[model samples]
Target: MITSQTLRQESEQPRKCFVVGPIGDPHAAHGSPEREAYEHHLGIFEQVIAPACEKYGITAVRADGIAHAGDINEQICRHVVESHLVVADVSSGNPNVMYELGLRHITGKPTIHIGEAGQLPFDIASIRTIRYQRTRSHLAGARKEIESALEVGLRDGFELLTPARVLRGLQSGDGPASVSEIGDGANREDEDSPGLLDDFAVIEDGLDDMTADMEAITKTIETIGSLTEQSGAEMLDLSEANVPMNARLAAVARYAETISAPAGELNTVAAAFAERMVTMDSGVRAALGLIEMTPPDERGEGTEEFLEQLMSLDEAAQESLAQICSFGTSAGEMARMSRYLRKPVKEISAAVQQLTSAITRMGEWAAKARALAHSSAT
Candidate 1:
């Protein structure tokens, strides 16, 4: 069995950090306005961002210039949510870029926003953006700036830097306050206040529901165990009663043989029948005693029905066997006494075949019935 301690140990393993960036757009690829913007950012990422993260043993995955045929927004959003930090180029103020940036901000993750000197959007002007010129000199300068920013951000601590933590801090049950209360000029603090409380409430309610469900499941399992025990008892009782049915079947078989035999063979047939009857009676009595000894609760469901069916089949088989033996006895007697009459061999052969066929059919039916009863009990 796997214990909670084993699960915890497995979960304690370290995971690699994920990096996010923009990839599509001709400017970011070829040499367009967009390309220049992307190139400048790429140089910074490769020279500064990549090397600094490597020093810290953190993995860096660039999202810049990746061509995906699907919804770009959703892809970027997923990456942003999964990444440890997002280094965004807001130089062009592209709608898609801004959307992804907004998602990162809302996630409350470590984000470093950078752009060309004059390209930063007015809306985010308040954010301290790293300014860079389009020239190689400024690109190098931007690289160093980014490298420093990444090192600081990475060192600041990544483990406790999650959206949930920020939310918890902002709410703290200290009354309604906005992010501005923590020094951010934006009114995001107020917007997030009510939602955070609601989220916490929902989490609590879910835990309560789960606990109740587990209790119900426990009760259900107990019920199944009890029911299974009862069914077992019933089956035991049925097994015990199967013997008498066997004896009765044997008697019927003997009678069938006696009736089919010639008058001269009657004595032989009777002797065989009597011997069979004695054996069957003893077996049947023993079977009944076993059944009586079985406990009521221990009997399983459909046990009685199955036992009855089995007994019926056994009785039928015994009858058939007895009939065959009796017929053999009578036939022998007839052959001896009726040697002068010269009885038809064909008639005797047909009678033997008919009785054999009847016995075979009965056995097949009994087998099918028993199988069905066993399946239903299970």
Candidate 2:
């Protein structure tokens, strides 16, 4: 069974490990918060991912470090699906990172999950993830863990994670099977010939992510609202006390500064949500197209289940749309108020503006989803 060609193929090429995580804003200025976060992630790559991968003769590349000049999203998705291994840092549960990791998970490939201690998302908590603190020793431990996992995985082969394995089992008309039955070659085959259920699974996973993001957004919005109200009341009291104009303006500016961090965070989270919205929109259209192309009688098994899931998603999308509209209104009002301040805080104004824009785009995506769901129902 061992052929020369296979041996040559194995020896000739080195494996690639795609590093997926928050790269931070590329254009963020040095010493700025955004740039600091960017540098922090770079440190992790250099200190943890690179050294561990080098030990196994694997070349590790992150999305930002890619040299070729093409569509970035396209390139990242290609790497995620085609890479021999993936090392995903899920510390903050960044939406874009989660989306790419979800794509990799669908392939049932070798993936190593690592994250900061106490920051792992609940959705993926059951899966084994290497947790590390920011200390040097912790980072070293993470690197060693990655190396050990890679060594065992490459030698004996990797097994599918729970979600993908269960989905594949369902598609195969068998309940979840042992690793011996669904691992390695069977997983590769499933990746190569994904069925309708698999496509639906992708959409469903995205919806779940979107739902969780919306909940977090809602809480953020509420927190900002509370801060704004408390600050407003304080400002009114200062005015009633016959405080000097300059002092009142100083209070206002300080309040703007107080809310600026939360506003920026909202913008970042909203932007990521918007990216996922675009993906969900494309996924919805693609799934709808497939359904339309199939004849009703030949729609095959699971058609009813697919439609039911779509209906459920439509309901969730509707709820999310309403929440987004409300959040947009709140953000717009805050932006306007910030601009009216004597010493306008450009940072807060700009952040809220970006958040509003992202929310608007999400609203459009939600509408499109509803339209597609309606069309499919009829």
Candidate 3:
């Protein structure tokens, strides 16, 4: 399993553009659950997206090809949030793909959407999907269109209002801001100097660092899972056996020690994640602040859509970190009790129960956060 740490860049790297869409291969027939669709998508990616990226010196990749062995959700979050560009195929409105596309939409970045003419959902049907027919003869044209879209998107797409922004404006009674209303100017002193969307490189780097921290924390969670699973049988047997209470207490303490090392490691990862969350959230707020400089006619309703999502993500991350600390604290306390207690009468039961409850609740919290983090649509 390769963690993000292994993939971290020590120096500047080419901007990345992630390909989002269904990669499933169905077998049997058209519209059948067994129909294979990945090959079709891959061809488009290889022919269209890859060439487009190369022209701009950007690297094109997809979620499946990522070499990391951490939480799949974490990996996707980094890509959707940090990628300089995204080319999504709404060929079927596949729920997961749409969810990712929805997340990308909230970013208000350069996103080029393409779909088969007949497969687009009603909500997005009029959004100018680059229509493509699936045929060998038409493949070239489709690829060219995609390349053209990339060129156009990279040059001016960032200034466009995302669907989220449009919807948000209506919901908040801010009235819609047309694409032309927003000016092309950005902070001049930025590293993307003279390029407004260029600071995304900084955002990308920050998210990548956060990804590394998340991957590390997830690995420790896996370790804890293993330890807990392996010890479950022993715990049950000890509960059933008629051993001395002190012996049983010592046994539980020993069991607690088994997870102490991994728990401590997780604690460190949690702290790192918390710190990164604060930094990342601050950067996002700053980006919003910069965008807010445009006059009311140009500024699209305060960028609250993006701000709200980032804030939700930030709050969840902090909660996850706290849950991790709870687990670590329980483990530490158990280990200490084992070291200091000569004989356990009542304290042992309390410590054991506390550790068990903490581990269970931590798992629950992690699962919920992972689900939310993975879905931009939510």
**Quick one: best TM-score, which candidate?**
2
Per-candidate clash tally: 29, 0, 6
lDDT of each: 0.46, 0.67, 0.56
Off by over 4 Å in 3: 1-11, 25-35, 167-378
Model 1 regions more than 4 Å off: 1-41, 64-73, 157-378
Candidates in descending lDDT order? 2, 3, 1
TM-score of candidate 2 against the unseen true structure = 0.54
Q: Give Cα distance to truth, residue 217, candidate 1, Å.
A: 57
For 115-214, candidate 2 gives per-residue lDDT tens digits of: 9999898878999999999999999999999988766665555656765665454343434323232222233443466565564776677767866766
lDDT of 3 by residue, 227-317 (tens): 7566667756877986677877776777666666665566555556555544344344334434433233443432333334344444444
Residue 229, candidate 2: Cα error in Å is: 35
lDDT of 1 at 183: 21
Between prediction 1 and prediction 3, which has the larger TM-score? 3
Model 1 residue 374 lDDT score: 56
Per-residue lDDT for 51 in model 1? 60
For model 2, the superposed segments whose C-alpha errors exceed 4 Å read: 1-11, 170-378
Best by lDDT: 2
Give the Å error, residue 348, model 1. 99
lDDT of model number 2: 0.67
Q: Per-prediction TM-score, please?
A: 0.35, 0.54, 0.43
